[model samples]
Target: MFLKQIVHFSKKSIRLSYQFQTMSTFTSRTNIVTGNNEWIFVDNDNFDYQQELARSAFADMLHDHERNIQYEKAIIKTLQNLSKSMKKIHILDIGTGTGLLSMMAARALNQINNTSCSSRITACEVFQPMAKIAKKCIEKNDLSDCIRVIDKRSTELDLENDLQGDRINVIIAEVFDTELIGEGALRTFSEACKHLTIDNENLHIIPARATIYIQLVESSVLQEFHTLKNISQQNQRINIPNDCRHLAGNTIFDLNLNELKDSIRPLTKPIPIFHFNFKHINEMNNFTEEKILENIQCNYDGRIDAFIMWWNLDMDEQGEIQLGTIPVWCYDDQEKIKNIQWREHWIHGIYYPQESKIVKAKDQVSLYCFHDEYSLYFDVGTSPFPPRSFIPAILSRSAMAAFNSDKRRNKYIKVLEKSFSNSSIKRCLYFGDGLLLPLLILEIYPNIELIILQSSNTHLNHCLEAILLNSTIKLNYQIISSLDKNEIDFQTIDMILSEPFFTKSILPWDNLHYYYLIQKYRSYFRSNIKIFPQKARIRCLALEFNNLHKIRSPVKQCCQFDLTPFDEQIMKASLNVDETIEPQSLFEYSSKKPTLSSIIDLIEIDFEKNFYDKIEKKNLEILFIENGICNGIAFWIDYELNENIWLTTGIENENDSWINYSKQGVHLLPKPIYVQSGMKLQISTGFDFKQGQFLFDIIY
Candidate 1:
């Protein structure tokens, strides 16, 4: 019997050891070979690793002093009030990422020092990695004894075993997205109240209530994302399909509405639409579906293109300590607005109605605001419109904005018309993700044979085909998935053009894949094939971002509690997996160019020349003209259509503001460096053609 026990123990130990070995040995590998044909193979241990990191914008939330302070105040207030009555208090922190709130609760309880009242705080985190980190953070702050870190989600926690049968009197949670209930907050709260908490009238929720407010706006800038407009050229017109025109994209544009002040024209004053009381379990349970009809008086005479949505949190029970997500213009006290905390975690959301409405000043319009358990939708007029099926187009708002830009569309039109008129372009090849340029060219010269290199996205291909079928013009175009010599007569192709877009292109330079394609199919092309963008230039500028830097900044401490463990883990993960250069819509982020050098052209690639002909390296020196802290280096592409026609995906005008349409590449520095006037900075930049990646290093 002893021998049998020894053998069983040995087998168990071996199994456990094997499992650990397998986990430790697991690794991710990526190989990129850029030669005649660029090849990339990526095998990752976890496919969602990068996505998980990106979605968990913890640093951004932690850096939000306003949110932290408000939460801390609310927690402290709740504890103080609860301690007055209850002999023992139990606190439950739901979705406790990094254990910030749990630590706050522990500290709050400690501060109260109510000898009669004892407190037990339990923090539930679903993400195991984050849960472990939270435990470490709690320990680092010396709150391990006071707070219990549960690896399971709040719903998964057993009241008897996990909670030791302690009835939760106070529940603190921040399970909210840009849209108030989008993150399953209703279900979470309802389930907690039903299963996790004891049925008691004195039960308290930190955020006692929430109110959703919306303002009608007339924004031509936002209209492009929801509907496709007709394209007209030289008496010929390509009409958008009726279905496509009315298709209200299901996507909610969550952004900092303050930055889009120039784009949005307010049609109506902000009105409270939906109110949810978190403190009442019955209220949250009954909030499964709701439709509120509001008669809003329009203040401006314009078309109602969209509605801007924001929410206010009544953090404390008394409703005095409140947090609002309203934009700057909504506030009457401009001075108070300046002091209001800016947070990307809970920015305003824009919801497009199924169809836009035209309203005049003093006109009372009936707006129906509807919300289910997880999503919100709206309709204009007396009755709610019929639910419309989502039809995918260029779903990316940035891409839609780029295609809708009159200035950009005109540039492509002019260049295409001039090229067609000047040259004997019998056949043309379109080699980009965007269909606007190809459609425009076809509209101008229908007789010209066009071959479109089909994008990787199958949905986009289907949408393009539908548009083509709906067009009145007899179009001669073929969208081929690949450049097969047998399928496509490449030698007969006259010119290659693009909006220079690619689904795979995350950074601005990723669009350089257009040139890479040209090089790949150079052998099949005619000797003197014309390229629409004759050359491409990459430009760089040093910038000091206002609040954008906080996304990557570490949260060492929050509410006087040490959060270094969370910071260290995030920093390590970022160093290992995060991209050096990230793509950001710079228009949304306010940044100032350091008084260093003017925007410098880093490198220029001539489409006519072979990309792999030579290895490119550049070393440049820039001197600062004034003292400033440089946090980021912004880079953008300039496509030279001709000697006179140049299209920039960067700062277009002399005002130095980035064009709102396209996202530019920004390389955030590891840390902000303050530079004195006349300080020389050395920049070493290179393009690795073999790997199809750019390398940049700045040294002072």
Candidate 2:
């Protein structure tokens, strides 16, 4: 009865909660909207609760036992030291998402004073939904009497009303991002010290200090994401324009460097770049901007491509409790470091220099590191004091990676060369967002006429034009921004091809837009036309993740505090708006393949067939070969370029390894199911044409 009542209450609360929606506008004259007359409303509530809960990093951070225990130890030590000198103690937690840190302080105070009535603990969360959840969690842990929750930003707090005229002696916060200062940690600390706390010898901060470290490396793989590279087809070469070769965008690429061990070659040992003391407000104020020059000797003879950055935090005043984000290669005990807790919230940052530098062994190079209040940039040799403003690139980092993939480039070249070798093929049409595939076909047959169905991105089209003009070979091609019949002679087109990539594609199967396009425009093409990728298969496999599952897992307890209410809210939100399959870069995450079943083909699409004719429901069964917990099902698409050649956006080996360029689709189960050996499971899968998505249901 109690469980039923709780479920009923949760449903009621969900309905009462306000849903914030954004009103999109069509600014382009080409965009046409046909609908009834309606006035869209707007407000200050710009938050999307569904997206927040789906992509929340709270669960991932909480699952890190090392981080949680270190924080608890730091808080206990701080409170213990304060109890010796002060009669009254007040603590403030800024941006407390789940009240875990606030609860830790409350519990530690109770242990020190036998009763927490002598001390006050206040927590502020600007997000109302999270503030309510935090209050419920505090009540669940029976710490409501000691800890106070305020649903307001720290900058909006009133010292008299919110803090009750009690000057806070200690402040706790976790506002650091991958770049440490990118989330405005310095601003938050400066404001809290000025308005929320008292200036005294007893004033304390949880993370008293932070030190950043960087190491230069020469990696051709990393260089692909920073700038455009020249492409060669047969004896012809397509050169990148001078303006686009060295251009680097301002976006930071943050990922796990441990997975790319084979790709990166360290050119120099790690060196300290910058250090900031968070305990002192005056010191933080003085850190608005600074430039440091270090002379380092190179250990390897290679071109310096990029720098890898990570930081370590001194959590307590004594600096005994420390947490670092160093990669395995940096430590002597690599295996022990790998065994440590993995955290995605604080990963390594990969920063590219304005230009690549060639260094010899024992060569001394002058490294200049510059940092503003919230961002970091680097340079080599004696250039200007501060680096020049970053020039944005037309292609994103991911798009460049796809273009730089050697495997993909080789396959496409072979297929295109074979097709163009036939003199009978005169005209062709290319559809997709890839810039290189289209160029490769043009280079293979310079005299053949080609029409490109350009993507919605105007910048990509500009870059394509620039490259074509810069190349030595004269190419015959036309780019059509929209699918207009009058723009080209579609009936004369002999072949159609695609890289099967779309700007709006979010999942592996979303690229089925190619198939949909072929079906929709079948009347315009010739009856005997050729398709580069004749068919596609949707494949799936059962697997278990090491720590990726925690992103979607429910947190029942964290830091000795019950979080049932938080879990219930997340469940309700997920049911309403969360997608079953999400796109993830599987290469950065670790997973184990199940011993039960081999890969299964859930759906197959033949571009030559009609959509309705190929739609069918499938019901299959599989038996578990070994006992293990099934947590997720991974999916990828395999494109058959020819009778003997194939390409996949998933694992390419028997060892369950993935290609680093593309992201795969993953469906995490609501709850992990334990299966015994020889246990049978049923799977039902199909496609919903109306929604333009695939569906799957698994039963054990």
Candidate 3:
């Protein structure tokens, strides 16, 4: 047995707690030991160590001052309501993450000290590390006697042993996930009502009730995450089947929807679909399935691409101190909305249908919301409503809209049109997965011989469908099975066109797939053969990100709590992985002027030349122009379409139309580096076409 001890300091004295751990009890050799607490897991790979840190919870919950203030007010009200009774109160704080709520409850008890009531809080946490930290935090707040930290999940707690056979009178829990019931709140509530709570009418739940609100809205901005739209090939639209247009996917979106209200167009009024009564035992114990059917009348004529959903919490019994997660535009009182502080802990949910719904003004549409034990699903109907059942619908939607993006489609049209219209280009060969360009090119130049080589069957099928749909146009074309250099007649072929992409892409440079193809066919090409992108270059620069780095690199401490364990986990998990750079509007999360030297070119490649053989590997050193914490590097590809026309996925001071259309790449550092002006930073960069990977190492 291995013994570890934890020492906690208070204003008056220091207290120590010890726990014994046996190696046999652990499923794995690796365990995080912090003070006297050991966090054991089956395998390190199965756990998100950063998520299990107390600092993460502190950073999220502390920054949400609005949530903190509301909870404080609600706690006061709860204490006031409990003061009316003369009985002693036993409170159970389920999922007492950092013991913040338990501390708040203990503080509220101070105000009602003369109520002739004595109160005690039993705070429960599943993670041993967090529970130990919570215990220390409780002691630091000088509330150790009032609140006892139990290192166990609420479900695992026994009434006879853990609670000393006494049932709880007041229950306070913050077990809700992005989706209100995602963290098994329903099960927790059901079990608590059945076993842990007292059989009395005076039982009080801090949050009396919760209601979910939803509205149908149309937004091109929101659609960027769902389906890819085809509106670039001479104003052509991709036709989707009507049967595939109903509820497609349900996902919890945790962003500030209030900021996106300007881009959103509401099609229907907001409606309350689901309600959960936490205070009523019978209400919770008997609850199984929740279903809602309503005749929703459309107020606007538009395509309903998605549903915007949020929730409201009734904090007290009277519902005077209510907490809401509605977007700013949803509120009628604009002044009040502006005055009310926003919260990050709770955000809105966005759901996209399988197919977009087209509705006109005053159309009576049937809206249905159904839920089982853990999740919610929504649907729509007309005059004839469908019978509801417990059967689960496939509520999953694809987030990849690469094939559907209008901007991408437009770029392809411009490139293909340039290739087809040039009289010098008689014979052309294309190598790309995007089928739209080839079909569009064939429509324009019917006499030119076009050879296409696609490896993906899905891309080929899509092309076949487009060819069938556009049967009116005929073309001279041949699609070879492979991109074999021997099959192509280089002497006659005047041009080569490609979108430069592959299925296995995580970073922006993965599109170097185009360079690899060009290199493979370079020896067989004619001297005069033209390439669409005359040149391609990789640009890199240092950036001082605001909070964006936190997603990849864990902070050492948040709100004065130690997060070294989390930092270690993040560094281990993130090493050697080619991270996917999410398309972020950096204006929101990154500082533009980290240094005066902005976006310096790192490497350039000529598409027409065999540059892959003579690879450029450099150990470049750059100096900082200003003093700031350099968290990471941002890079993007600059493709020279022609001499004057260039396509770049980099930062630009452009309008929403341009920014939304472009994509930039990023790589977060292991930790932030505070550099002063003239500080030299060394970066080792290399790209191997054979391996199809870009290597970058930052050396300070």
Candidate 4:
């Protein structure tokens, strides 16, 4: 519970007080005040309130025990090595999120010699809100005397004033994202080496060196996310021209390595592409350097769909202590993937090429890797180009790729083919975001009259472009923003075709935009008008996925760190917001672990009936089909193209028709529960009419 008190002093002064309820889960103190305005009227210089109440991101970091354990071991090793030197150890810990490393260093030094108080640590946290928490953590661990929390980014720290004119002997920093250098680590290291850390032989960096590796793989499953696909065994009747070239690249693709290990097939062995040696300051140039790996022979005969990448860290000087992010299948011991030591902070990376490259056994290719300050780009070719500054290509290759997907084109072809079979439906009206439907309709029915209603002039121009480029058939179509009832005749329109999609659709239910339009235009259509999709339904099922729950809630602790504080902070920040439930492709994340319940229908929408009416709340009782741990609920939409033809976005079966082009959405339970066979689970679900969103509630 949270309570606020407003105390009004004279008209010019005010004091606002906030009291946050104590979290018993972690034994946090009661009546904790995160922010108060009492000091504002007195002195604001020393007044610092917690600015970042959201702690999910931080909780995620603390959940990685592999990272925490390795850092502890590294810190211990560094302190043991420094003990041999007569000079006192001055450690500079940068980007200390929880002051875990500083506390570890202090604990290690204290264990070695209780009488010696020479070693000191200065932990720097750029987020002042987080810095205060780091200070609390240090004090909680009884190491406040040895480690001092500095509320400033490393770059902002003045060496002379902040460090008391002292050069540091050791530097420990945790500041790398999935892209490795995405967090501006290059600049941080470049400056720290120049001004902060001593350039002496005794200086030691916790992570001595790091190396990035990449391999080519053939994965149609992975390509489905980046490019278009056609999965039917039969030949497609309609073909969208594919002419887009790879334009650019972005941050690394972080995923559950264990889930994708068996899904991807490799064409080449993992190759080391870049290495950064933190001990040697000059190695920082790897961020801006351009390099080429030439004549790499392909080991397998297959088409290379993507480049999978991972990096390993050498934590100690002897390289005896190291941390690797390689997936379980990559290791000799497959059990490692199931091990908790496999961390989440750093997962594998994937770089998708503009087009799939066909490679035969013994075939050789060259890979060119270029980088600017904070990102890496890869280009595959037969030879290397001269080193030059990186320039991002400006193109709509992604949009073109989406348009060229086979599965999507197949849906359009099947729908139009099935609808055209009705002899009475001659003229068609298209209402959608693009003109792809207009072009395709004209291709099949060359003599059919098509009228497209596009709201944006920009989209209308695109339609003209598609028509201009593919002029095989002269289309009888008119583009209009809206139908003026006074000036237009609606009697001739006998058919309506739509994708039932909207640009504002972030959630699956947002597709109601199409239904809302139909509700508004139902009276304008002829009595016998036929809609493309006859009906739509919502279906759901209870599932168990251990890895999926880890993203929503932490099941592992980082060493001896009390991560509950961070978890509590995050839960409070997200009290009113539904951040845990999200849209995901169940096809990519299915478990051999048995499901608790089969698919259950939660709601149904029959386009034949009135759908614009207020949605009535639904209460469902689902019996367990099998005994298993139920972690969440998976839901999807089913669109009935015709009476006999159906396209679904739900969980796909190996034997089912491979025409599901839509991704399913998931709603994770607040906590996982083990249900026995025949047990009934109660759930209530409905639509938030005002917010245009879906609401789900699980009752025990």
Q: Per-candidate TM vs. native? A: 0.91, 0.90, 0.72, 0.82
User: Tens digits of per-residue lDDT for model 1 on 162-190?
Assistant: 99888898899999999989888987888
Better of 3 and 4 by TM-score: 4
Instruction: Point out the worst 10-residue segment of candidate 4 by lDDT.
Output: 27-36
lDDT, candidate 4, equals: 0.65
**CA RMSD, predictions in order:** 6.3, 6.3, 9.6, 8.8
Give candidate 3's error at residue 672 in angstroms: 8.5
Q: Rate the local accuracy (lDDT) of all candidates.
A: 0.77, 0.76, 0.64, 0.65
TM-score of 1: 0.91
Residues 476-526, candidate 2: write the lDDT tens digits. Answer: 988887667886778899988898787556577777778777777888988
- The backbone clash count of each candidate, in order, is 0, 0, 4, 2
Residue 115 C-alpha lDDT in model 1 = 97
Q: Is candidate 2 or candidate 3 better by TM-score?
A: 2
Candidate 2 colliding pairs = none
**Residue 183 lDDT (model 4):** 84
